[model samples]
Target: MSTDSFDPVLLEILGNKFASVTEEMCLTLQRTGRTLYVKETADFACALAGRDGRFFAYPRSIGVSGFVGLECLPAIEAAVAACGALEPGDVILTNDPYRSTGLATHLPDLHMIEPYFDGGEIVAYGWCFVHCSDVGGRVASSISPVNTEIFQEGLRIPPVKLMRRGEMSPEVKLFLDANSRTPEANMGDIRAMLASLATGRRRVAQMLSQHGAAELGAAQGALMDYAAGKAEAVLRTVPEGSYRFADYLDDDAASRLPVRLAVTVTIGGGKVHLDFTGSDPQVATAMNIPSCGRPHAWLTLRMLALVQTLDRSAPLNAGLLRPLSIYTPPGSLVNPEEPAATGVRHAAAIRVNDILNGAFGLALPSVLPAAASGTVIPIVMSEPLASGGRMVQVIEPLIGGTGARQGHDGVDGRDSGISNLANNPVETVEAELGVEVLRYGLRPDSGGAGQWRGGCGMELSFRILSPGSHVLGRGMERLLFRPWGQAGGQPGLPGSLVVNEGQPRERRLGKIDVLEVEAGDIVTFRTPGAGGWGNPLDREAEAVLVDVEAGFVTPDHAKAAYGVALIDGRIDAETTARLRAAQTGSEGTVFGPERDAWDSIFAPEAMDRLNAALLALPLSRRQARRREIFETVLADLPSAFPKSPANAAQAEAAQRRLETCLAETS
Candidate 1:
């Protein structure tokens, strides 16, 4: 092997070594973490940043891939400014989105940065973050959609030094302990974060020892270039042009009103640009994405996995973003300004992924897949069984279907568009809390009707064996906009929740808060289904008959949705012929008109521009700006907020807000 180009085998070897280092760091944190989200679900990320503050190696399939572009430079700089000197035992803590320039979007997510030294000189930093239990302040859980100001949410730690030259800071510890609902759990998570930093520091130190400081630094640069090359190659494969896609949030959690996301993806040669020009402005709610107009956690996701997973050896760095650009106007949902409450940025990110998928599908028609179940639902239950004794039970984070890619039908009842977390076992929930698991199975025939039918969602039911319990479920997406299908495939069913003794009083609950339940209260949760892949009528006769026999489609729905008549588990010849004849003229996706209306106004150009406008306004005015934008579009429509099953009164009220905002913006 020549030194001029270096051996390809050696490059592969060093790449895998760095990859293992990050993976091991994750394992260490997971082993020590106390929270179920960390220990069980794995909603965390770990990475190694170069001296310049950009990550060189990020885990591809583990943790949240969107956080790969986070810069530790800001937090490091803040620590140096606040604490005069640094030592080996020192670690910095921060979750102030504005201070970190959007790196730590929410309060519950604690971010820590540690500097690693080589020959007495600081060479690089190791960074990690985990979603902890609580941080005290306003709400009982510390995070709610209603929290507009940072002071109301929880403790906002600037880059205060958590560890000073390797010793724990008592002052910082005191503040943390005083401000959290579960101080012990928070502290355990903190220790986990510290452990993560130490792991990264050790790994970096090891690489430095073996390769020498200069060679390690050189490797970082080389790896970044390599990622850029691989990413560009993927870009070139996407036929040079533009593709657009849009999705929505059910509501801001404060009202019945929905939020929209529209994206326009432009690809030329090897570079891609994501323009979120027409999305709603940042709202008062916590769902804003604090991007700072660069490739933020929310924006970098599509490219991160697309490049790295396509080539596992691609450098785990922002260099993948080197050949890509994001155009999110400041103050929009994707790029909110300072003091904008961003506790739920991932809520917006799920929509962003859908948008990217839609756009990419247009360019790479054969390569891309249809829409998925498109939501992450965590069935949270808090029970105080015996008089005043409290226990929290997370049944499981219920997810829906994965999209059907070319040459394959979509997978049933599983998705990872956001953080690909695992579902909690029924046994685990029952073992820990005051509840008995009733049902943990798939919802039969809940998927949309199509030639290449979408995947079905899930149904989870449980009985509160003890009294005085509080039940909460959140992170639910695709409840408003049914996950759309491509190339004439039909959309899927929306989700719902019911509470009762399996009777008519089993209410279709809206997105909920803590609900008090007594002994014998039976609760059932039905997740949404995935989108279909092709024209339903074009579906095979045998497939339709199978759907009927399997209880996936009713005899009536088989005739309507698939345009087939299945009598005695066999398709009627005349009906099949008519269905085929009717397919000659139909084109475009088959999502309902309600979804179409939502998608139109919240287009990519509109969203990017709206967010940019929001960024200019003070943080206090973000909600007002967003509400106004949506209201303006709905003012002229007959059924305002089309996604909702609206009546005249609701439409009038929606129009009032829209008309008022439109007039003001004008």
Candidate 2:
């Protein structure tokens, strides 16, 4: 049977069945999983993949939402080539990003694939991955942004059978147990994954019994084709032209210099091509994205978001990526070479999503929203136990608000731009770990000011109750450049970390490696707010008053940002009218004061030329040479150069010095 002969109604039914199977698998994994990251934060995902290795059915409301496009074929092929053809009840496991052809993105994300057989022939594969607590690395949780190579990140499990012929492989289990800091917890999650795969296998067999093998195979292709058509229709709505945009990570964890990500999206004839040509070279830190030059999930997540946003009923599968093509420059941040650490690749992916969002927004201004709070920090705590061991668990998955759109305000204290992870409840955190939750709530006046106000950021303050405890806040970003606003809207506030709120012993820090703390030390994490849409003066005074009442925007902020005066909890229309008349509004994307100052010295054109020259050199020399040029140019400026804008004479000298450096490189 071919897709042409398959009935539409049957295809829809099969699509629902396939989706439900994956969701059931997810539920099983979550219900039986051990770690806080798995059970509470839901950093795991389950999907059904076709024989070609691409996912045909993915869960909608569970697990990580951005990995629908991941390919499982490479790992499948690698396992088959190494250990011969797969038999019944064989499960292939791997966590090596490079070895698995980008299937397993990082060390902690343990990916497994189990072949489902019908009449002694393989029909579909069940796939699932969990972000394990530890895989044995230099740091406590096996992920540190400062790690320069993949070997230091964690244990690299190749594509081998963790379970063969319905029996667990003791050799593989032994190696896994020896390599992880949380061996018992890892095994518990592994068992949960096995249960998920078994659940998927049973569901596939039930579907086969109902629809027969031939019709089931045909429905897989037919459903994908339907989704592809819907995605193409959405792409056609976008204007036929090239839209270019770029954004930055605050800095590589090893250095203070920022990392750049550039993208040029071309949409024409119901197809989109993303060219990541001007992105910076792969960094020496763990912040590199391991895309392997394919249209990886990390590189093209925004396109998935766009199609889903336009066509709500489109099926969740690899077909959504059919109309998209990507070109990530070799050795660039998006396509790092082998052995480059990818422990925190999601940090770079968050910025990649921003650039893609910005480029697409240029084409569909009314459809796409302003920038989101571009950060996701998984604040983890490692407390000492009485048995001379350490207890490691995630405290909270911190994130800010989503960007405001043309007609709708952004969602406050919740941004799913990257991973849609749920925060650990305050009571759960206190119960699981040795900490007192001081405050967990939204920050007032954190969102950008506009007609449709941006979402406010979150604040988490806690005091350590255990002596000699350590805190790990990985993926911290948006400290320098704010989340940019659109259509003359103001930029959002940047993120900050404070050791203590109002004490002389307070010590403010940027992105940390591994922070050591003692009992009574209070730690606070404030995430960046999202960018707003349209001019603030155009926002209704009543809307500002409502925001003030809800504690999202303070009374003084309402007057300052939106030009609305609140008197006795009521909007003063007369005062608001005067303030609006006096206030001036700017047009186009507003990148706030910090970006404005940085752009004055290191302009886009200059950076492009510099990167082009640097990319021409050997990979080993790119990072060092690039660092030298920046250091020489910034020698005469203040220590905090970009944070504090340079003087007129200083800016001129820096620009001239940059020109000379580029000329010499040429």
Candidate 3:
């Protein structure tokens, strides 16, 4: 192999080879791993990193796909600083978000790093992570969105060695065993992670033996450089301008106030800048993102997606982030200080994804798609057993659909825009938990209507078989503000949780902390749908009839949204022609009636100004000031102000109150 200016053919070959090594390592872990998160959800990933501690070869087919851009340098440095130089046989382990500088985003994700030795020197590093079972804390599964600090989330393991000099550290094992509710399961996953690292080490040694050490080093650098060039080339295609957008999470689980994430993307000089200065200050909840600023993976995922979509051949590595720069204000949601609970960081990340997509859509309207369902909730059930302890397992990791792009419909019941996680099989979920799976199917007529329709959402219903069973659903979102559409498209419907549906005792829940139910109780979860693209009137009449016949679009929606009449699973062309001729299309993008109502009271420009002002104040006073402002407006409105639409008179009164507060504050 050529060391200097290696052949392009060889570079591609080597890139594939290295990436395959990571995949093989992942396969090894999945085969040996002992957890549903690994065998079912595929929550683990393995990668080969350069000496600089940045990934050069990341598995594209398996594991958490968004973490490819994360840098391992901080975690490696922290480990070395704490435990001297890493030897060939030693492996460092950590799940501390702050200590590893965001290498491990949350406590449940155990990260392991192993050094590959060749000729008495470190050639590359092997990195992998798994979202293991319960880490003992305030609740089972060790995650609660209402947890105020990291301490309440779970045990935070800093950068320490689980293995030293090829031997498992007994002290680390003792601590791990003591601090977890499922010690055997957690250790089983840990051992699987170690096996993955060993696989990577052996693979790296073989590659080094075949290609020579210097050639391997040169290949790593070349792969990154190649990816960097590709990323820069794609970024240069985005129109040179600054576009600003802001989005909101329904609320921090502990409070009614919505959490805001604002961004401004400036694309120029063949590079992009993401300025998150106007985002809300860190919340006192687990939703806070511990990005540690510095263009972290969670913060830069959209940019990476944009580039990859434009150029699919671009290598998946940290180098794709070379042309991007980021600014996250200190103490902000995106860059929270240490000890902030980050158990539910993904909830914020989906909003950040929307904000970035909205902002970039302004600059590259044709290239970007509309907002997706913008929600991912993992529904878990823990039931008391006949013998002892609780039998806990995730029923399903529920998610909604992807947004529609120009000239194409959004994908239904699948959204890989953020994390590409597979849904758990009903058979597997039923075998593990004390529940009877009743309904697991798509929610018909849920996708927003457009020329190219948005994707439909999912619905899951189950019946409890055991008494004293508890259901936990975390990271639930899109319950309030609907997923907005683009270019005259309509927003999708909001999600909901219902208990004992079709019964008198049924209750509609927007968000859940924890709900306890006895035997015979039934629970249902319906996720929101993605946003559409273009005017619904522009959709072909035949297409509307097909959708109606297929049960995807109702006959009523066909006539109302698409201006096409359908009768008895057939198109009524004459009535459709009359309806189309009489109907008037909406102008530009539509964010549904609910968002419009909220925007009337708290307009975008006014909210931007308010957020800037709140950010300028002291961190301790920001939340208080924001609450005061919102509460004053909400004082006169209904209890479910935005979720349940207000009357015209009530909206006007709320608008006046909001304006008065903004005037005084700004």
lDDT of each: 0.72, 0.90, 0.84
Clashing pairs in 3: 488-588
Tell me how far candidate 2 lies from the true structure as C-alpha RMSD in angstroms. 1.2
Please provide, for model 2 over 272-373, each residue's C-alpha lDDT reduced to its tens digit, 9 standing for 90 to 100. Answer: 999999899999999998888888888888898899999999988888889888898899999999889998899899999999999999999998999999
Highest TM-score among the candidates is held by which one?
2
lDDT leaderboard ranking = 2, 3, 1
Better of 1 and 2 by TM-score: 2
C-alpha TM-score for every candidate: 0.87, 0.98, 0.96
- Of candidates 3 and 2, the better by lDDT: 2
| Each prediction's number of clashing residue pairs | 24, 0, 1
Per-residue lDDT tens digits for candidate 3, residues 1-666, read 544478889888889999999989999998998878787888888888777778889988788766533562355555555666878789999889898888888898898888898868988889899987778778878888898889998889989988988999999999998988778888889999999999988888888778888888899988888888999999888889999988889898877788888999999977999999778888888898888876887788888888888999999988898888889988889998888899889899999999999998998888788889999888878787677766567788898888887999889889987788778888988888788999998888788888888898999999998899989898999888889888888888889999999999898887786788889999999999898888888999988787777777888888888999877777888998899899877756678776776777777777778877877788778778888898898898778767677888988888888889888877
Candidate 3, lDDT over the whole model: 0.84
Evaluated at residue 278, the lDDT of candidate 2 is 87
